[model samples]
Target: LDNNKFVETRFGKQLKPSSKSTTYDDVAENYDGQYRFAPIQEAQVSRAMIKRYFETMYDRAISDVVIVGAGSAGLTCAYHLASTRPDLKITIIEANVAPGGGAWLGGQLMTPMVIRKPADRFLQEICVPYEDEGAYVVVKHAALFTSTLLSRVLAMPNVVMMNATAVEDLIIHEDHAGQQRVAGVVTNWTLVALNHDTQSCMDPNTITCPVVVSATGHDGPMGAFSAKRLVSAGLLKELGNMRGLDMNRSEPAIVNNTREVAPGLIMAGMELSEHDGKNRMGPTFGGMIGSGIKAAHEALRVLDS
Candidate 1:
């Protein structure tokens, strides 16, 4: 009688309620006895996450291709490059603790990410779930989309991801033709850069590569940094007025013409707009992925020649 009234089974065997109502204390005691609960310490989780990334950073000190930002474009570039050129080592440096850039938290973490119908192929290739909604295709989940992309790139044997790292400066050299070419980059922990610590300026490490893809999004930190260096070296003339150029109309050009702005330095994604003074395409994923593909192909061409 007690077994029938006091217990329930998983196989749809619901025992009748006992004449005595179960009190809050009795339920709590039963739960406590049935399950042992131990919360994970926050410190332990933080250490494990940090340890995993630092190990990758320490192992791959140099790479053939160094992508400055691990956003959609950077990740896509790595994936395509690895698929096409498995022999070449690719390293992606991201300032944030986590990868995926704006994609991880889509539109302030509230809105779903939308891609043009033209970019459907990229989603399909990556096996991301998406549905057509008239003019654009919306990803099923922004988090899933970003994570899936990240997972694919990270799974590649040639790709090494270094997070919580910031690219502070570029190492440019004058080629035989007397054109200043980017050769490497100076980097430091993101915390050091963000804190404005003087040590960041003095104690930084360098990664040398023949080709550097500046996928630094719209702000284009790498492009701006390179432009200043090129101008100071008298290799690049000062930019003229860009007020007449309509950015909205130049999106197509931006996507198609993401090429090498400086010797050994290629601009991809929104960095194209910064380097070329083109219009910004707000929240557009197709252009970003296309820019990455174009940059990867261009880099391979340059390497071949």
Candidate 2:
């Protein structure tokens, strides 16, 4: 799909939930996308998603589709693009010591400390003894698979894998007499782990691209989010329904800002909790993968144009 095939603003194309009822349960009512019984599926979905994104960003002449987290969504996106388009230039920037953000989260599926019924059994199977190959293999597979895929992709002339870098600001530029533009990102990071407790970071640096994909996992610094943030915050004031990201924060993560400040910034794999939204498949891997795929599809549409 070419970029021109899709409109810049896909008005009226927003996702519609299967349910609209505002139940009394804050879980259901207030608005958040969460559910149980899904984890590996999310990984599968995200893998499929970033694959399409690679093709799109590649053709569009966009230099980089840099992802901040590089854990689940970031790594998934990287592999997807790398596998499909070894020619495209892709980068993954992670803050944590390792990849797989949600993998180490520590619930039943996420954090293991607080145990549940089948969850305990699930954890037990997937943990130390490694009875259930499901959990063990899942993580093991991610480790082995991603490593192999990454090795091949990295060997390709087009990929750059950066770990432990913190991105701080964005650089935006306009082209075609200010009608269109390019974007660049600035980040500060620490490469050497002097000690587990204390480490120093190198000076900040900037990487520029015509089209920028802000896949920081969590809402980045302050302003670098996306168009969704502004619309969610600004429009709600007039209508009295501020129903979008940044649940607890004063400012939401996905807002609409100028491209020169945030050029061609399209966001995907975002959380419904970030906005006034929820779903059984809410913030899980299922949603991010779906969104990542959708976002990539859209990005391809943009590039094809």
Candidate 3:
């Protein structure tokens, strides 16, 4: 698309790839460095990106699992699931341009991430270096840990990441036995979702899955969308929203309460706290990691059953 058309569709303007290629095959051939690079047509660059992205999307259009919100919990869940079950197709839908959610920034926009005792296992698994405090571990650069986690999860062959995409709603299904289940989710571009109030009637897309992992934390318009919407739609009982900050009480509560709330929907991360009305554990991440691990195990159990 041209700049204008791309802007209209994407809800923001971005540089369009030039159609013309100044150097189709030119390179510094004499350079013997291992990092030598070659030039190609700009159209090929766009084509490569489009081809891979569409292929992944098409393959995961009907996936085994769809994880909403590519936050710490969601990504960790995906990592564990993919590592355990290589045959299952998994997709993570993230509304933001970059994933990691709040983990990118520590408390008050700091760079250190604090993870309590056991949860540091996740960091160790991914080979992230952290300072070992007595009861807590501090990853000096929050971005480093998040980026490392993201990279490791994305490297999984069975996992596909749909970043900058929002989950508009859950696709609920009732079996012949009249048992209600969350079958999938309705999705749209993050830009479209953000401008939904002003945009034209734009139809969203669907992704079918046997199970869904809701890790969309406790803030933002779309956070807790699955669990909260379930209650609002009369599909589930009341979910007392998250309470005030109480790190000590909240951490354990979040981990213990992380489970499959409905037939096919599993709540993780801060979403669990919101669903169960647990205390909010500010910037600490032990509970989030524990919740993600539990959610992944739950999803695996559900799928195997």
Best by TM-score: 3
Local accuracy by lDDT, each model: 0.74, 0.42, 0.86
Question: Model 3, stretches more than 4 Å misplaced?
Answer: 1-37
> Which scores better on lDDT, 1 or 2?
1
How close is each model in CA RMSD to the real structure?
Answer: 10.5, 19.4, 9.2
- When 1 and 2 are scored with TM-score, the better candidate is 1
Q: How well is each residue in 1-305 modelled by candidate 3, as lDDT tens digits?
A: 54453322111233455577645233333554333667799999999999999988888989999999988889888888888888999999999988999889778989899999989888888889999998999999889888988887887768889989999999998899988899999999999988888967988999999999999999577788887888976877888888999999998888788888988999899988778888998999898889898999999989989
TM-score order of candidates, top first: 3, 1, 2
Candidate 2 lDDT for residue 85: 59
lDDT of 1 at 249: 61
Tens digits of per-residue lDDT for model 1, 162-218: 888888788888767876778877888888766665544457888988898878765
The C-alpha stretches of model 2 lying farther than 4 A from their native spots are 1-62, 105-157, 175-182, 190-203, 219-263, 271-283
- lDDT winner between 1 and 3, please give it: 3
Judging by TM-score, tell me the better candidate of 2 and 3.
3
